[model samples]
Target: MENNMTNKLPKISEAELEIMKVLWSNSPQTANEIIEELEDTMDWKPKTIRTLINRLVQKEAVSYHQDKGRMYAYFPLVSQENYLQVETKSLLQRFCGAAFKPLLVNFLKEEKLSSEDINELKRILDEKTEENKRKDR
Candidate 1:
């Protein structure tokens, strides 16, 4: 599933995002390492993951180096937060009218988060709210 990679920021596919999730959690991985992680959660073959890697490289989202005997190791060029922000903004613009409240409300209604998670989100919101107030002042 190859396509153009000329977006203002490159777009990562869901499959590639899965690989990135692994990379973000523990990056600078080998292809085999990524395959092993996927094996635990997905019914995917090595080639499929390899294809995802190639796509990521083409999108400039991943960088690789050949080691002893041409073994390839990969690293994420873009950060998880950057990717998520781009995707979230795109989603908001396209479907949510660039508003996050509706999305947040939907997520809050649908998902069960831990108290710690709730508190952390609240802290983040409060921090942003405070920053915005300062800007207005």
Candidate 2:
């Protein structure tokens, strides 16, 4: 793990994650803009969306800048990759006993992976194996 990712991170709920997704796609947007983007998918009311945004802001996951006419444009402070890493680690610890092979095998058995997917996994494994061999020297 990188040093930047080693520090403690704020926990985001499912609702807050929805808001973060909106910001992540197109950042520095107003609350109304965010609501508009999610209108087709989410049935959440404007107030509910605002509440989620506020929660994220309080958590320091999202920040806002002053836009035109007193409006604030919000953006994410944490990258999606960083959050995924934390989530993956937590999941591994809780469900997979901090081991990756079991989780990966479970996924492989559950999902119908295509040939491309299998090949990609093979490529990644090869790269990892090479790196480990280098370290063993």
Candidate 2 residue spans exceeding 4 A from truth:
112-120
| Best prediction by lDDT | 2
User: lDDT tens digits, residues 7-122, model 1?
Assistant: 35677788898988888898788999999999879889899999999999998889999888687889998877777767776788888786779788999999999999999999
Native-to-model Cα distance after best TM-score fit, residue 37 in candidate 2, in Å: 2.5
Candidate 1 displacement at residue 108 in angstroms = 2.5
Error of 1 at 109 (Å): 3.7
TM-score of 1: 0.78
Query: What is candidate 2's lDDT per residue for 22-106, written digit by digit as tens?
Result: 8888888999999898777889888889988998989899999996689988999988888888888888888878578977888
Clashing pairs in 2: none
For each candidate in turn, the TM-score is: 0.78, 0.84
* lDDT score for residue 28 of model 1: 83
